[model samples]
Target chain A: MDTLRKTRWLLVMLTLAACKKPTENIKIVIDTDVIKYTALINVTDGQNGSPAPAATTIAITGTAANDIFELSGKKDIKLSSGIVTIGLRPTVAPTTNQPITVTAEINAPGYNRETRQVTFRAETKQQVINIQLTKTGSTAPPVVTPPPPVFNNVSLTFTGRCPNRTDLEIRPSVYVYFKKSDSNAAFQYLGYMDKGNISTNLLEQGGTYDFQIVYGAETYKVSQKIDQTSYNLTLDMPAACNF
Target chain B: MYFRRSIVLLLAILLRCYQVNAQNNNQPPSLLGQKSILLNVGTQGVGAEFAYGVLPNLALRGGLNFIPFKAHNVFKISGFNSTSNLSADFYNVHALADYVPVKTASWFRLVGGFAYFFKAKGDIRVIPSDDYKYGDLVLTEDQIGYVDLNVNWKGLAPYLGVAFANTFPRNKFNVSFDLGTYYLNKPKADITGTGLLEGNSSQTPQFQSNIKDYRWLPIVQINFSYKL
Candidate 1:
């Protein structure tokens, strides 16, 4: 009986030690989209579709300009790689008949000043506006090229990876830039990626392209060879997101 | 080894007391052959058990228990008005042994048991309430989405407690109160979300850390037993 009691005591101690944190190594994934009804304004050179100069500035002026905010919920929006996403602040909404309109003015050295009207309609939650510029003196008419073949629709899912903080992730809601992997051409405006998912018909079967997004002044890039209808891509956001 | 020796010494003292009482009193107020089935309800929910006196001052009990409950609007997140639905289901079957050390005061007993919890899960889903606005646009329920937090701790748990009355009926019927705790197994927890809330999954680490030490489940219960 004494031996039996000793064994029971040992068993109780062992049971207490058996408890280990089951979720110790688990990683948490979080989506990045908080603001809805956004428009991605992408500025580029009209002739070659190259990114605008680093000194380029964008100014919003209109009745609804004050209500617009960056996707990160900042009022003072700054362009990264000549791209900035503008959205109606969470407190505002657009109606079909009364669409919200804002004038986006782009100015850069040696480039003709340009202004484009961006409209946010109630029916459309996400949009992309391309603002192409012309040089001050160059009278080169906008090149009219033959339309490319209608490629199959391809969907891409972008997941942000944070190296320092493995638990932090971002389902990026930002403008996407894509270019042919073999071409020296600059990245062109693809579309607005909404919470990691974007579908476009520009990617041909078997074609390879490099996709890029500039967030927090850092350019993150990922490459994929288009083969299937859908692809999952990861963008390294080592700094993660502050907002 | 020292702990084992201390428990042995305590048991020896208790045995000596019982032996002395047996010698002084001829009958010793026998509790043996006392058999009863009890219906219980309290913090651990509702349960039914059959208790039988196996020794002059000891009884054995085995039973099953279950509790299912749900509550709403218990949580909020970051100024977002959320309607939280919390639901928990726990079902267990257990067997326990009671040792009444003092023969004169047999009502007080030390109890130990092993309970096998077949289903123990707590789930909370927080959905943004109606009138959620994103800028000027009111979001539909599907667009705003919901977040679900789930925790499961189901396995064999050890129970230890003290009972305030005889487990078996003293007369035809008797009521008893018990205070105890069960050391539950480690829990598995996860957070998932849909729509705009899908990013809430990243909060799993914080949630895990907050709940890591929640292994002890306290119980305060009332049991009514009837002798056959």
Candidate 2:
């Protein structure tokens, strides 16, 4: 009876030992995003920051093997052993709103290196600076046309004033255009429209030869060359909607 | 010597119980000079069932065979980051003959036979969905929907169940209440996804069934049968 009891105890001990469970291995994954032409610098487990790819290479076309964004100031980053991985993302691609893909690799000295693609997008200014690449699309000063010879010596109480209420000197704009080449060569400067005299000037010796107005933002050129008589010059303001 | 004597005494007591029940439990051997034929009739799923005196120690059980299951009520899924509330309806049915080897007065009845499970799919919710990426939340009143489900048998299951029937002769009619457990291995059940649960149950949107791990279904049974 004693031997039988001893044998049962031995069997129970063996069963308990076999039932001790083992530890399970777990896997971890992390994701993030960035833009082009910019650097995403993340501080390592150490005091220093490291670039996402560890180094910059041009072959980073897609998110396959070795595609990572470059960081200008991160090189001597020291990461700890427990620090599994670090991810970096740029603000946006060079010109478009599409964000660049970031593939992260953590290579510590004595530990196994970890790698994964951190996908994300960066915010970008949607509207482009479509302003003229040059003078072709510039919004600067306008052009003027030479007036025809006023040989008629015609001057009768000439009355005119700059309609522009403000900034008449700095970014001044005129309102008239000559339809023909025989129009006036120079435009008389009537003082400020609001404060200048409105009552007429003393009648000069000759009658006035009316030419097109020249003070607005209109461009004018000689359309016709008739030398004999003082033909009236046509003044046309661009449609109000064009401004 | 001790075990042998105990068995002999137990057998003697059982024989007396059987003889007394045979003489006193059933109808007094009909003076009409006629005997009712003992027939065992069972149902396919749900109805009435009974047992009759066929011989000395055996009885034939028959009735409206009815084996029904509770419709699935609550459906839930735990995703990577969130959990969701879902709903499903399910059912079960059984039809077979029970052979009881013990005497008429024996209280325990062990019976094993065949059963069928019919499942009908209802309606699907979460429409116009091509992808399946959703967070988990409790089921709201708005997320509840109904669809008609049809249950049909894909195969048959041989099952086992037990019934305890007590008899009383008040008006020459036999009535009994059955409390039993039926086992179905794997029956065909059509499950339809409706409301919030519709999008996650299919293969295309997400590769997961709405409800998993409820293979063995336990249910409650109440039966009524009359001897002819």
Give me the candidate number with maximum TM-score: 1
lDDT of 1: 0.74
Q: In candidate 2, what are the lDDT values of residues A141-243, reduced to their tens digit?
A: 4332233333333211112212331101011121221222233333322211111111213212233433332221122222333333333332232211111
Docking quality tier of model 2: incorrect
* Alpha-carbon DockQ of candidate 1: 0.12
Quote the positional error of residue B152 for candidate 2 in Å: 7.9
Screening candidate 1 with a backbone cut-off below 3 angstroms (N, C-alpha, C), the clashing residue pairs are A30-B199, A31-B199, A89-B135, A90-B135, A91-B135, A92-B135, A92-B136, A93-B136, A93-B137
**lDDT at position B161, candidate 2:** 63
Q: TM-score of chain B, candidate 2?
A: 0.44
TM-score of 1: 0.65
